[model samples]
Target chain A: DVKVTQSSRYLVKRTGEKVFLECVQDMDHENMFWYRQDPGLGLRLIYFSYDVKMKEKGDIPEGYSVSREKKERFSLILESASTNQTSMYLCASSSPPWTSGGNEQFFGPGTRLTVL
Target chain B: SQQGEEDPQALSIQEGENATMNCSYKTSINNLQWYRQNSGRGLVHLILIRSNEREKHSGRLRVTLDTSKKSSSLLITASRAADTASYFCATMTSGSARQLTFGSGTQLTVLP
Candidate 1:
């Protein structure tokens, strides 16, 4: 089965601290995405990468950034962690936007980030 | 309030009964996809229906797409307690093949 893996399942950071969440996929899919899930807000995209060394901002990318140094890995960075940023971070991957048959996304277990 | 909007933000149903969730999008889409997420976890894709398709089914899950109404629905028949989770509908907008905009999802509970 295809799998997406996140580096940390849980993290706690102090305010103004820089935090990084890493995601890796084993399927060689070219699309990677980072999202934050809140109780009522649902899943809000923070960033997404279509290919290595290329990234795009999503709906809520104000305080977030992403990096893709390799096809199998995508990283999400928080320049400065804040309490408001405390939420569950999810990483997902999909076919490079060109393939057919099950182009659906595959997700990681998720990282629960706590900003104090 | 996003492109894809799911109705009845929360639902509670008994096992063996069917559970249905509805989603509406604001723009034209190439496909509509549904996902399931357990509490405090990541999402797992359930199904995807292309714009040209009207209905599709997998196991106990049935999805229907209506391009004209810009809406779709997911029906889970003979639900089980294990089916309790949050259901999200994502819209793949026409011309945007890279990013799929997601909406607030519906929290489903199948009580045994």
Candidate 2:
């Protein structure tokens, strides 16, 4: 089975503090993504990387950034954690864009971040 | 902005009953996918239906797409307590970055 793992399942950070959430996939997929899920807003993409060292901003990229230093691992960074940023962070990976059957994203368990 | 919006934000149903959820999208799509998310967990891809396809089924789950209406529906037959979760419909637009535009989601609660 495809497995995606997160660095932390729960995290608490103080305002103005920098926070990092890590995600790793074992399937050797070439695409990774970060998203934040809120009660009513659903899943809002923060950033995504199609390949190593390449990243693109998503719908809600403000105050969030992502790094894809190596294949199989992607990290999400909160430059400065804020209360409004508190939400469930999800990481997903998929096959390269051009590949057939690549549209389905395999997701990690998720990281629940609390900003105080 | 979200490209899709799920109707009836929340639903409650008894086990063994069928639950249906609808999703409407704002743009042309290459395909539509459905996902299930348990509380505090990441989403799990359930099914994907391409724009050309009208209907598809997997196990007890059935999905239908109406490109003209820019809408789709998910039907879960003989629902179980384990099936209770949030269901989201994501749209994959042609020529886009391969990232899906997700809907707000429908929270389904299947009573045991």
Candidate 3:
């Protein structure tokens, strides 16, 4: 099975503090994504990367950024954490690009972030 | 916006009984996937049905998609206590957005 690992499962940070959520996948997947899941809203894509150093904005990209320094690793950075940012963050990795096939994302266990 | 909307946000069923849930989405899609997530855990892919296909089955789960109505239904036969969890339908849109548009989800509780 696919193993997508997240840096932390539960996190707490003061408002205005910087936050980082890391994800790594063993399967050499080309597509990686970061999403925030909330009640009623479901899972909203924050950022997605097709290749190292390549990223694209999703439906809700404001106040969030991502980095893919390596093919297996993706990072989500919160410049300044806010109370509104407190939610469940999910990381996912997929096989390859769209032209090749519809990439099916395999997700990591989400990190519950709480910004007080 | 979420492409899919699950009917009956919550469902309760007796053990050994069947549970049926519906999902409706706007716009065309290449495929629709069902996922099961236990409390506080990552989602596990249950099944995927394509637009051309009307129905698909895996083990005890059956999924059907109706393009004309832009809706889908999932049926879990002989549901067990272990089957208690949340189910979500995700629509795989056409294009570079391989991203799936997920529904709000339906929470199921199976009573033993």
Candidate 4:
């Protein structure tokens, strides 16, 4: 079984503060993703990393950045966190599609971030 | 932009009844996947149907895909109270990298 773990299940930060959400996967997958889920918006991808030091912006990448210095770890950074950034942040990992066509993703228990 | 949109945003059914949800997409896809998320939790991958395939089943779940209409449906047989969750449809567009565009989910409630 694949296991994806996040650094925190819930977090609170003040406005303009810097926040970091960490995710680690044990499956050695080459693809990792960060997404923020909101009511009526579903899960919108924020950023994704295909390989170490390789990152791509998803649909909603504003106000957020990501780091993948290591294959097992992916980090989401919130610069100057605002109240509008408060949402359930989810992390997912999957094998590259080239390796397996239409690969399924494994998601970590999300971190609910609250910005006040 | 959301490539897929789920129909009947909310559904309620009694236990032992079947629950069906539909999803329509705007573009050609390499594959479509269904995911389930409990309240305030991460998503769990339920099933995936390739574009070439019409239908697939896992356990009590059945998924059907129609490329001509660019749509898909998920059916849960003998629904139980534990089946209550938000179901999302995700699409991997043809010729795209590994990113998946997800639709606003359909919230399903099963009454005991």
lDDT: worst 10-residue window of model 1 chain B: B94-103
Give per-model TM-scores: 0.97, 0.98, 0.96, 0.98
The iRMS of the candidates, in order, is: 1.6, 1.1, 1.6, 0.8
Question: List-wise, what DockQ does each model earn?
Answer: 0.72, 0.77, 0.59, 0.87
DockQ of candidate 3, scored on C-alphas against the true complex (2 decimals) = 0.59
RMSD (CA, Å), each prediction: 1.1, 0.9, 1.5, 1.0
Clash number for candidate 2: 0
lDDT per residue as tens, model 1, A28-57: 898899999888787888898888999988
Global lDDT of each candidate: 0.91, 0.94, 0.90, 0.95
Q: Pick the candidate with the highest lDDT.
A: 4
| Model 1 spans with C-alpha error above 4 angstroms | none
Q: By descending DockQ, how would the candidates be arranged?
A: 4, 2, 1, 3
True contacts kept of each: 0.72, 0.67, 0.44, 0.84
Where in model 2 is the C-alpha error above 4 Å?
none
True-structure lDDT of candidate 2 = 0.94
Worst 10 residues of 2 chain A by lDDT: A96-105
Assess candidate 4 and give its TM-score to the true structure: 0.98
Docking class of 3: medium
- Candidate 4 DockQ vs. native: 0.87
> Per-prediction TM-score, chain A only?
0.96, 0.96, 0.94, 0.97
Rank candidates by TM-score, best first.
4, 2, 1, 3
lDDT of 3 by residue, B27-96 (tens): 9998899989888888888988988999999999999999999999999999999999999999987655
Q: For model 1, which pairs clash?
A: none
